[model samples]
Target: MKKFTQYVFCITILLSCKKIGTPELQPINLKISTVYASTELGKKLSLSKVLIKILNVNTNVEKQLITDANGNVSFQGISAGVYDISATITIPAATYSSVTGEIVDKDVIFNASDKNKTIGLTNNELNIKLVSGNIGNWLIKQIYYAGSNTTTGAGYRDQFIEIYNNTDSVMYADSLYFAEIIGRQSYTNTSYYTLPNGQMDWSKSLNMPSNIDANNNYVYPRALFMLPGKGKEHPVLPGASIVIAQTAINHKSPFTGTDGKTITVRDPSLTIDLSGADFEAYYAPFLPRPLTSDIDNPSIPNLNVLAYNGTDMLFDNPGRTAFIIFKRDGTEVKDYPKYNYPTISTPSSTSDKFYQIPNSVIIDAVEIQPNTASDRVPKKLGASLDAGYTFAPNGQYSSQSVIRKTDRTENGRKILKDTNNSTEDFDYFSLANPRGFK
Candidate 1:
């Protein structure tokens, strides 16, 4: 009886010494469903496979998977956390009628550590039109809109645009009018937007010609920076490019802004020396203080500013704007029609006036905006003018640029992609590639 009592006492002591701990963590299951299909032409309508990339925002852990025919893929086990999943798919041009599509969607999610979840992706349809109009022998090669590196944290003075002759024969840059568009970015801001409430009424904004339809003709820029030349003063040969700077004085050198403060270029390698630039946007001496960033280069002719709104000839450093380069026959000021912008609410105000230049004169056009999709609005340029839009990645003064992609070449002439879709035609580079081509 004494031995049994001793054994009970030992059991009680052992139970009292036991420790408590949490249960082990369980792995997560990830399932993705892609949206795809087939067409009447027996071609697969979408990408044969989908690319799924999941990034853990906290730990920076990455997981990738390719979806099969069923548009389905699953991860066996994943340690759950906050993740950003970006999915992309491309349809072959052969499948569609010369017009194919590409889709990309990035997401943010908080996944549970031990749960099976499915991410259903909505399939987007993009109809990329083959260029209806010939993109011409000349192309706008690179645009350094994001400014340059500076020690003072202000470096937009180096803003420059580059053009190229992609044709076999020589083309003239003479009499080319480069313009910066000014208007509302999206339809949501009715008070500020040109066409509020997404009105399809073209008569409200455009000044159409008698022979043209309002749908085709668009509202052109109010002010134009005209390149002064008679006929062939500026000739661009095949496989050649020209840089147009705000100041063609080796921007790599130090520059003084309106503040009269010296701004040192942090990385001269990041900027180019445009000392031999083809042209520069030179404003007149009469131009006031703030707009005086327009440095004068006597050797490089000034682009005549045709002002309609009485505003200075300048660019909005942080605004959603568009640009175009065009040359037309009889492009003298008289050839274009006069447009008076009547505020949607106040038609009699006569606050805005414009000189409408038709799309026929536009050689090339590019639409630029902020990088986010939700922040973007209806495109200002027509589908025929520019089917897609491109942007500056990191807001204003980020030192980024939108560079055009080379589509193909015929003979020896390089034909940059003129698909009019910025998504396909343009891409973002870490640093600006200016005058990379002579």
Candidate 2:
């Protein structure tokens, strides 16, 4: 019994002597700041927003804090450790191309204290340069599908940006860098092919015996050519920039080719006649049936435009005027006259069918007298009719008789009239140009 009592006493003593430890919490305080580009004496750099990233080395966790408009940021109650803090300054879009673009990137490090205190960092601005003017020449022509029209067609579309020797004389190909800017990266597609040494093959530069207007010297000029439907070809989205070299604008030509300074890169802004030459586009309009549908689905009647880029594409919707033809059954219809323009209506949406007009039919011309004061051309071309519509009987549709005067800014940055309406009540149709270059 005495031995049992002694064992219980030892156990009690052991329990009473137990030790518990409390962890010591060390609170941390940090402050971060950023600077912008400056050029004046003691000029303080400003930032739209600043971000500070504090990293804890032991746990490998990060804590982020954002600065106010005054370029001040702070972090509190942080875990105590040797933290590495970096600052980032953000520039707004309006200032992005202006002042912020000129700034270069700079980084700085800071340490947080165990107590609250003001910590300032400097020169955390990112270096950038503003691209004020246009960079390159090569303007993209048509990016179309090799076969049919589908969103996937964008992937299969053969892309080409036609480079113009806007400069009178021919330039060297070696001095130029032809490329597409996709995001932050620039892609180059320069060829060693001698460009515009003024040489041409017989079949390449030959003009038809009867037609003199379509005759040209070069065959495939210094244009960026890519095979459509090929895996991972040139892919472009809206607002993508295409660049060309101003110095190396010209290319070399093979032997016996015309080295004359007569090579002209066609401007897509001009009116390309379907019957005239300079039309080389790859299209497969006729596909075997059992396919899903044509280029557009759920198309609207009296509407025929594929894409709109402020007149960049043939179907530019200045006011979202771009439309596709649709039957009453919600299917796309591509028949001529099924979709045109200058459609008629009763000012109400209930009207079933209205007469329409095409957007490209030419009407008349007015002669202007020669005047030294004005550098105007001798004649001004008029539209076939205006852009309004007229009412007609049930069987007879309204005709686009008057000219529709709508302003359009062409590739040349010139405002041209959308002159195609004649009677305002006629059949609507898309322009029948195979190559969508013009």
Candidate 3:
């Protein structure tokens, strides 16, 4: 009886010891402060904010909280790690680029250690741009790079890009050229580029005598697609837009391709009825390419693939790409300096195929990236082009497209936001709703 009682007591103590040894993890405290970038102090940001959002990078978890009057926010006992914090603060209307009711938004990444980690969110208006005054009327409103999923579960032919005229007058889409940037962002990382590599590092002027527009224009393009039309042949009136498709046809209907094989779209709604699309991009030069799925519409004019530096111009599913629609003016291709490499990435590889486009002629430009921050590329567009880059949540082949935010409508014209910052100017949809018809 004594031995049995002792064994029971020992088992009870062992269970208690295990409970004491394996204590639950205690959370840590995180603090956040807000500020507005000061050009006076030169990059010094002042604090001001009412609310803030803290996001866990890995877990996709988010928390919203109000900041104290002093622009400080505290998260007690949060799992210590890295996080992205965003705060939108209303500043003096005259202080920032945003005119009326515009809020200065700032995002800062913080690493929260065991103790308290104070992260500062800075609203650097130095790079913030406004949609008014200088914003062009024509914009690349939407692009569906994530092709639809056909019945066979493969789809790329349904890709399309839509252009809109956000002005009160008609804008011609005629003779407009579309170029794909060859490099991620030329000025992103300059230390790695050297003259022996043929890559033009914006840091160093080639010194080779020429009137090249290589100063402010860093992102260069190798592929060029042009919209062939007379000056007024393709008139996109105010509040109007046009869809440029890979093939203008009802993707749902069964169709015969170059191989004389019937292709069917398993899900009708999943696909888009682009039969009425205004423009198409057909690899005219590479026509009859084996197993070429690209279909040409007899009614729609094709966007001549003027150039193709990459293997496929079908736009990458996740490749960070920057694009611009510019009218071919007197700017001679020879006038611009050349980045003599395939891309800034492959600096050692040689090629004289890239040319820089003067920013003035670019009607509108947009940069697409992956949903996550680390998957993003160095932003190529200046605050004048697009303040930031946007991405599809589902990434590739998800049929999601980045759509521009509507600022307002003036005199029957839809004035889309052109703050030159995609983060503030654009958002994503569950589906690619082209021309707002989703």
Candidate 4:
């Protein structure tokens, strides 16, 4: 009897050890739902066949599944951990136009993402609402904020941005405006005015109109420039792109700086030749002491600078900035009000002011943050404009760039992805490419 009791104790101990070795995993049941910007179209949209992806944040393991006719999907025996869930669906143009009475030449993509979600031992049903975004005809194709090597490459002088005509028809670039979005760059100062997300609370700025929803409805610009063209003067054909450079010159070869000095790169291959750039930013006239590299190319047109910042059109090399493109609307941008930072309770007469641009007029926007997650600031663009942000994975001075992904080619025309989520819609190029497709 004593031996039998000892044997039972040993079996119980082994069973306990086995349970500890393999903890019970939980199941995740997800429901996919469609949310239309137009409520009328919501009733007509279908929810089945949506692709859902769940990523284990800790393990980087991803699982993909499709929703059934009832918009239901399940993942059994998933380890409890932090996860990121995303869903995407494409609706045919004909179907979308027929349901909404809107005409679109290409399919519309709807995307949704829930980040840093925790799934514990308790299983629960989560509903993901897919949102359709504004289909933009002219989109920001690529951004080269990560300039070349400081010692061996062109440095910030090689930075450029490309804009593409995403539609099949010709779109004139007349009076189209683009700007470098400005916001609070730090997160440590709690005494300053900030939004719930820790972004600058522009509504708190002195002399800011109280009637308007400044925080959500508008964005401030550090620099604003307009593409030079009369109506139909600058026709961008379908699948074509225009490159805008800081200095329109061949960076691969030695060039004469504005200071009458020679500037050369140790490695020409690390930089690109922008002599053929369609437009360049000339800031010498605006700055008291302009950067020597801010040379102008007479052949290439200069963007009309409405608002200037820094000594030149230099992007933040550390990738702490956002950009947006819009067109002239009923209200003139020059007439828009400017205000000082909200942190200043009393502003002097000569305080620097930032131009407030209405979100309704913005055509496209992309938010960029530091490659290191800990240094990231609050999102400047809202979810409606850009649900996610992207950056050059290699960081500053790496000659890398964030380029939009190609969704598919229809009739040999490249249709770049524009799901209002840069993280999902963009990919990085090891080197910056002007007028190049990914």
Candidate 5:
């Protein structure tokens, strides 16, 4: 009886041991989804494929499951209890068409699990816009001032003009001039100045600024003066002429008319009425002189003047001088000599010395009302400093912030989370680690 009872106890112990040795099973579920996509122009997107990874903590083993076409994916039958779970997606170099498509990369991280728990994600469709050109459709439009009514005196007034160049090609308009008319000559003697037609100016002589941009035009009010004995010093005189001439005409021409040695003004519009006393011309407001053309009648409003002092016709520096001294109307504000030479000097020269130069006389300072809103305009600080500079590709990465810390060893990281290209200055991580490139 004792032997039989012992045998039954041994069998019971063995059954208990077998039960204790059995392994416990835990289940876990994982799911992944794309949350956002890239849409701005010049961006590279890779949010198409998604994957979820299930890992065994004790055995250091992992399994992967791919998501659906819409970046929707799931993982089931994962061991529970703080398992090391990860997710991954590869962004293949997107197949693109010329009509419009995506160019995806071969590798990029799409998504990952958070806190080793079943995480839910909603993938957002990425709409990436591509560009064939930089600064597309943006042209070098006209130059302009803030507005009118900001003009001060000769140097204080704010005035600017527009030069529109819509094409990508570079452009240049040099030797331009601007001026008002003083008076017209009698039919016989063409020596006297004539009235201006349609945006016309004195074309016989011009003093163009040195540095002008080819692509972009500029506008600014400037004090102007003619070369020694070139044109009339009194603009706005009854029937006066304003012209814009090339620098080659700086020297006097010996062309004679019915009267005597009368100058011949050419016109591009082919409207030259040689018999008429006045003609047309085109001159920018800030230019120092004008070109000669045919002038039937000018419709541009003549600038009105309130006061003019003949003695002080230029600034103390003498680099700039008023060639014509008169009010807006036919009346002469101050009678300047028929001609006066202007002296040019550097900044080191004293104002008094510059005005007293030999052979080159300086005009006195004149007070004119403000013409435009340029006085209140601020100078662009950034444009002048870094006019031509760009960033290096390798160094550009330093400027960006990393949104996702990927595990390369796990082979479970999403491929969309990687960027191996240079980023545009304005690009940012607004979507699921997607970048823009054009």
Candidate 6:
């Protein structure tokens, strides 16, 4: 009977231990502090009411909180795990202009992010520095790189880019230069020059200036074109946009090609009518024999082809490309130095050269990659220019385009979102829209 009693006691102890299991994980009390960038104007700006987002990396759970007047927020009793914290705030244009003495017609966005942060017993505090982005008057509203069906649709010939004036005043398109930023297109590591992040290292190029930063301060352009206008010539009204087309012809309707043959699309719905495009890229004058569809539009003005690549202004249909628009401050683009690729061995004297553009003059930029993550190459632009890249989910020849999201409407003026993070600011359109908003 004593043995039976002891067995029951032992079973009871085992069950109690099982119920207790391991001691519950101790939750952490995390504190986050937000600060402005290290600038005179930034120091004077207020940091209160900034939205803070904390994403638990392990659990895939997210929480949001607003910062106090002192720019501090505390997360009490939170699970101890890795997290990604981000802060975003928008400053009114009047407030920014008054503080900085800079004229801005639209609101300014500031963003800060700290990734892979751990909240444990020893580490429970984090500080995020918010950096202001370009108080953009013009923005790349849409990019239609992915064309429609190759056999039944317009293919790559319908690709175009739309730029919008996001301000409330008139803005000139005069002498505005846009280019296709060049970078490593594949992931294959080569003995040739490469940046630590797997991008092409232009500093190793022959005759590259030793005085200036070749990779960080400047970007190389595979193709460069500029709008032909004097100051105040092409005035884009508030909320208006300008579309630049590869061919300014109506793809929905049959058109006469440069080859004197008719060009038509089997699926008109898959394409867009670019006949109303403000500017068209005419490469026939520069190329010995341009594409048969590269016909000139007498009604549409042509972009000044400062540099040429391929046969036309053809974008990589699978994404794997980037674009930037900037205005000349003092120096002429023609005077800018060009250099060959950074080859292990010296390139030939007649090797092709690409023009280098300074980042200081860049007004806006967008980085793109293939729809699938496996096919994506290393990012070309830095975080300041574009924190994250965007892509069309349907991949190439899918008639898709990435368009900027509308943040809010102020007095009937549409303000597009510009967080410097394309992944969050952009959404893909199943069919490309020239002046459409999401």
TM-score of each: 0.64, 0.20, 0.67, 0.82, 0.21, 0.78
The window of 10 residues in a row where model 5 has the poorest summed lDDT is: 380-389
Q: Which residues of candidate 3, in runs, are more than 4 Å off?
A: 1-134, 150-154, 185-216, 287-291, 309-312, 333-337, 342-352
Highest TM-score scorer = 4
Evaluated at residue 285, the lDDT of candidate 3 is 55
lDDT of each: 0.59, 0.24, 0.61, 0.84, 0.25, 0.85
Quote model 6's TM-score. 0.78
Two-way lDDT contest, 3 vs 5, winner = 3
To one decimal, what is the Cα RMSD in angstroms of model 3 from the true structure? 8.4
Sort by lDDT, best first: what order? 6, 4, 3, 1, 5, 2
Off by over 4 Å in 6: 1-108, 112-130, 189-191
For residue 436, model 5's alpha carbon misses the true position, in angstroms, by 32
Cα misplacement distance, residue 162 of candidate 4 (Å): 0.5
What stretches of model 2 exceed 4 Å from their correct place?
1-25, 37-45, 96-438
lDDT of 2 by residue, 1-438 (tens): 999999999998776655321122445455554443234311433443455555553454778877687656667766555443444333433544354345323222111111111122332222221111111222222211111122211111111222222222333222122211100000121211111211111122212223321112111111111222233233332222222111111111111212233322232221122222121222113223311211211121111222112111221111111111111222221222211111222123442221221212111111111111121111111111121111111111111011112133335432222212211112221221222222
Ranking by TM-score: 4, 6, 3, 1, 5, 2
Write model 6 residue lDDT over 81-105, tens digit each, in one string: 8775778888898998988888887
Candidate 1 has what TM-score? 0.64
| 1-438: candidate 4 lDDT, tens digit per residue | 999999999999999988886654435454434354445666778778888888776676988888777566787667777676777778999998998788888788777766556676563457666666677989999999999998999999999999999998999887899999988787886645897667888888988888999987889989899998878888899999999899999999998887799999999999998999989999988788888888889999999999987887888878878999998678888998898888746767888899989888889999898887556677787656776778999999999999999999999999998988888889999999898888
After superposing candidate 4, which stretches have Cα over 4 Å from the reference?
Answer: 1-87, 97-106, 113-130, 344-349
Summed backbone clashes in each candidate are 0, 50, 7, 0, 72, 0
